[model samples]
Target: MQAEYGGDLTQITDLDLLAFDFNPALRMRKFIGESKSGSGKSAPKALDRMIWQRGLRAFVGAEAAELTINSKVTEQNRKFGRELGVSVQTLSDLSRREEALLMAEVEESGSHGAAAFALVEWVRKYTKSEPELEVIFRFLRSKVWFLDSFTAVKQTISVIETLSKQWVVGHEDDHKKAVRWLLAEAVSVFSLMLVDICSEARLRPRFEFDAFVAARLADGVVPSSEMKQLSKSIDKFIAGLLVAAKATPAVRTGAMGAFDPVPPAYADSFAELAWRLSRWVRASDLPRQIDFLAHERIGLNRPVPTMAAQRIQLSNLNFQHSVSLVCAFLRGHAALSPDASETLLNLAVQPEETMSDAVPSDADVASPPPLALKRPGSGADEFRGQDYLDFNDPD
Candidate 1:
C-alpha cells in the first residue's frame, strides 16, 4: 500500500512513528464522545459537547474514506504521498509475517490519527483546560469499541495523509472554515451513500442517518435555501430508489422470495416515511412523542377487539393532531405512497365521535399489551406509526 505512492519504505520519521503508536486510541476516544450517549450518571452538558466532537471525527473519517476510494482522489493521494515522503511498500515485497505486522499496526493506530490529533487540538484550544481535555479523552477512550477492518482503516489513513498537508499549510482562519464545511458536506454525502447501499442490498437501514439533519434544521443551523435543497435531494433519492426497485427483479425478490416483493419494515412505505420524518421532526419533542405513542399502543386492547376499539383508542390520544400532522407532512412530502398515506391518515385523523365506543374503559389505557414494539431500530416498529421516527434524535 505504501509503495503505491513511489516512496522508499525505509525513509520513515520519528513523527510518523509517534503518530502510528498513539493516534488510534485518540480516535477511539473521539468516537465514543460522539456516539449516542447512555442514561448514565455523567453530566449531560459535557456529554453533549463530546457528542458533537465525536460527530466531527465521523465526518472526517467519512471524507477520508470517500476520497481514498475515488480514482481522482487515489491519484492525488499517491502524488501527494510521494511528494511528502510517505513510506510505501508492495505487499509482494514483504514476507507474510511482515504483512501481518503491518496490517496489525495499521489496525492499532486507526485510519485518521493525524486528523484526530488536529481535532483534539481544536477541542483543547477551544476548551482551554488541560485537565478537562484529559477527562474527555479518558471518558472517550473507555467507550469506543467498534473499529472498522484493516482495509477500511487504511483508506481512512490515506485520506488523512492527503488532507493533512493542506490543513498544515493553509491560513488558520480559512482552513478552519474549510474543515467545518468539509465535515458537513462529507457527512451529507456519507448519508446518501448509506441510503444507496441499503437500497441496493435490500437490507433494512438500521441507523438513523438523518438525526443530524433534523437537529440542524430544528436549530436553524441550516439556511432556508439549503433546507429546500435538502428536501429536494431527499425526494430525488426516494424516487431513484423506487425506479431501481421497479427495474430490477432481483431487487423485488426480497430475502424471502420473488413473491415477497416488499422488503422488510415496509421498505417502500414506513422506511421512507420514518427517514423523511427524521429529517423534519422537532428533535426535542420526538422522543416524548414516541414515548407517548408507544404507551398508547401498549395500552390498547389485545387483538384490537374490533375496528371500533382501534379508532376509539386512536382518537383518545391527546396529541392525535400532532400524529396526524406527521402523517400529513409525510404524505405531502411524497415519502408515503397514496394508499399507505390514506390508511395511516385515516387512523391518525379519524373523528372520536364517529366510533361507537369512543371512550375506552378506565382499565384499557392502563394495561400493557402482551407485546410491544419499543426498540428504536426495529424497522417494523417504526412503521406502525406508534413510535415517532427517532432517527438519531439529537443530543
Candidate 2:
C-alpha cells in the first residue's frame, strides 16, 4: 500500500531500513499479475543475461521487460519462467536500491542525461572504500557534460566552416557582408551553447569563464597558467567576433569592398576515409587531420554531390579534431593569439594522468603493468616512454 501511495521516498541506506520503506511482496505480486496480462513477447535469454551482467542503467527497462514476458509460460521463453520468479525480485531490488539515490543527485544537478551517463560509470567503479557515489557521480557528470558541450560547439563550427567557404567563394559582394555576419553569429552561438549546456548542469558558476577553464584543464589541453591567459583572450575574441557579426550593414558592406578570394569547396568523396582515420587516431592527431583536409580542396565549380562529399569529409573528423580545426581557422582569419596556439598545441600532448581512461587501482591489477602509450595505428601494442607525433610537443 505504501509503495502504491507514491509519497516522497526517503533514502534507505541499510537493508534493515528497506523493511519499513516498501512492501516488496506486494510489489512483486502486482508485477507478476501485470506480467500475466501482457502479450508475452520475450527477449532472447542470452541477451537478457548479458544485459543483467553488464548492469547498465539505460537498459534496465529492457531487462525488466525481459523479465515480464519471460514470466508467462510461453513456448518461446519457458526457459526463464521458473527463474523469473526470483529474477523479477532481483531486478526490482536493484532498481529500488540505487534508482532513488542516482535520480536525486541527477535532479539536483539539472543535467539528468549527462548525469545518468556518469552515474553508470560511477556505479560500475564505486566501492565501500571509494568516495561517495554521489560526489563521484557529480564530478564525473560535470566532466561528461563538458565533453558533450564541446561536441555540440564543434558540430556548430562545422556548419560555420561550411557556410564560410560558401561566403568567400560567392562573387556577389552584396551578400558577402551578410554571410560574414552570419558566420560570426554562428561562432557566438558556439560559445553561448557551450555556456548554456554547462549552466544547465550548474557547472557554470562563473558564467562560461570557469567552465571553459575547467574543461580545458580537465581535457589537459593547456596548463593552468596558459589557460588563465588564454581564457581572457578567448573571451575577448568571442565578444569581438560577435560585435563584428552584428556590425551595421553599411559598415559590413564597406569592409567587404576589397576583393577577397574564397577558398574552393573540397569534394566529400574522401569523407568516409576521414571517418575511418578519426575512429582509429587519438585526439592528439587531430591537427594532422586538418592538415590532411587543407590539401583536399576541389574546384569551386565541382558538382553538387562532390561538394556535399567534401562537406561530409570535413564533418567526419573526431570531436577534438573539429574543435582544433575551428580554432585553427580562427587563428588564420580572425584573432591570432599565441596563447590560443599554445593551448591548441598543448591539446596534443596532454599529461598521461589527464588522458588516462581509468586510474590504476590496487583492485584493478594484481601486478601493475608498466605505463605505456599506444601508437596511433598499433593495435594492443603499447611501448614504454612517450610516443609523440611530429606535430605534438612531447614535453
Candidate 3:
C-alpha cells in the first residue's frame, strides 16, 4: 500500500531523494551503494534533472545541487512540490523574506505544511547562518512567542467572562456554561501541547506517532485491563464535552450589541482536554462492567470471565472498541483534533482559500442550542419534537 502522509510506514522519501541526487558524492560516500535501497540508482539521477529545470536544488550537506540541470531530481521535486506548495528549488532559492512567507503559507496549507515549515526553518537556521537568515530566525522566534502570549491572554479573559456570566445568571444547568468550560479546557491543553511539540523543531519529513505512543505506554506501565479502563473514561469524557459543545450557541445577539462568534479556540480546548483526559485514563484501573459493555457494542466473540475468577481475562476487543470510540469522537470534532490544531495554526499563519471559504455570514452566526438529550429509540419522534421546540422558542 502507498504510505499515507502521517502513517508510521511512510519512509522519509524526500530525504532519501535529497541525498541521492543532490549529493551523489555523499550518497556514494555514506552508503557505499552496498545497501539494496531502491533510490540508489537511475531514479535520483532523473529526479535531479527535473528539479534543476525548475530552478531549485536539493540542499545536501554544505552543498546544493541545481534541479534544472538534473532531470531525475526535477521530476520528483515537481511532484512533491505540487502537493506541498513550494518546490525544493523554491525553498533553497527563497530570499529570507520569501522564505518566511513560504513558511507561513506552508504552515497554513495543512498539518504537512506545518511540519514542512518547521523543518525548513530548522534547516535554514542550523545549516548555514547568513545575516539575513539570522534576522528571519529572530523575527520568527519572536513572532511565535507573541502569538502564544496573545492566545493565552485572549483565552484567559474569555474564560473569566464566561464564568462571570454564569455566576450572574445563576443557571447552573445552562448548556452554554458547559460548552464554554469545554472550550476553555481544550484551548488550554492544546496550547501547552503545541508548545511542547514545537520545542523540538527538527527536520522530520513524516509524522510518526507510534514511537511516541509506545514510549508513553511503556512509561505508564499500561496493562491490558488499564488500557480498557482508560478507553472507557476517555469515551465518557469526550461524549460529555461534545454534548456541551453542541449545546453552546454558535452565535449570541442582544439588544445592545452582538457578541462575536465563538472562535476556533473551542476546538483547541477540546484537543487539550483529550490530552489531559488521556493521562487520567492511562492511570485508572480497568472497569470490568465498562469493558463488557464495550465488547457487546463492538461484537467480540471472546470468552467471558472464566477459570478460578481470580484472573478474568479482559479481551483485546474492549481495547479496540474503546480506541474506535475515541477516534470516532475525534473525527466528529475533526476541527479540534491535533491534526486540526496543526492545520488551524498553519491557517492562522498563512490564510488559505478554504479557510476564507468557510467564513460565516452575519446572519449565519448563532449561539449553540441547549443540551436536549434525545431519548434512545425515539428516532423521528424525538427529531419532530426538537424541531417543534426550535420553532416555538427563541433564546
Best by TM-score: 2
Which 10-residue window in model 1 sums to the lowest lDDT?
63-72
Scanning candidate 3 in windows of ten residues, the lowest lDDT window is 25-34
Where does candidate 1 stray beyond 4 Å? Answer: 1-318, 348-395
Tens digit per residue, CA lDDT, model 2, 189-284: 343343233222222223343334334323333444555566666656655665768977565445441322211122121121222222222323
Residue 4, candidate 3: Cα error in Å is 40
TM-score of each prediction = 0.18, 0.19, 0.17
Per-residue lDDT tens digits for candidate 1, residues 1-395, read 12234645663311111111112111111111121223344523322333333344353332111001111123444454344333222223233645665543322111124543464455445434445333333222221112222222222223322333333322355344333323222222222222222221122244543332232223233544556567666656655676766756444233222221122222233334335434332322332332223222211101222232332343433234434544443344323233332322333322333234457777665745333222223232323344434445544
lDDT of 3 at 106: 26
**Whole-model lDDT per candidate:** 0.32, 0.33, 0.31
Clashing pairs in 1: 2-88, 2-89, 3-88, 3-89
Model 3 clash count equals 42
The lDDT of model 2 is 0.33
Error of 3 at 129 (Å): 17
TM-score result, candidate 2: 0.19
Query: lDDT score, residue 351, model 1?
Result: 33
lDDT of 3 by residue, 112-138 (tens): 234434544443445243453343333
Q: For model 2, which pairs clash?
A: 267-310, 268-309, 268-310, 271-313
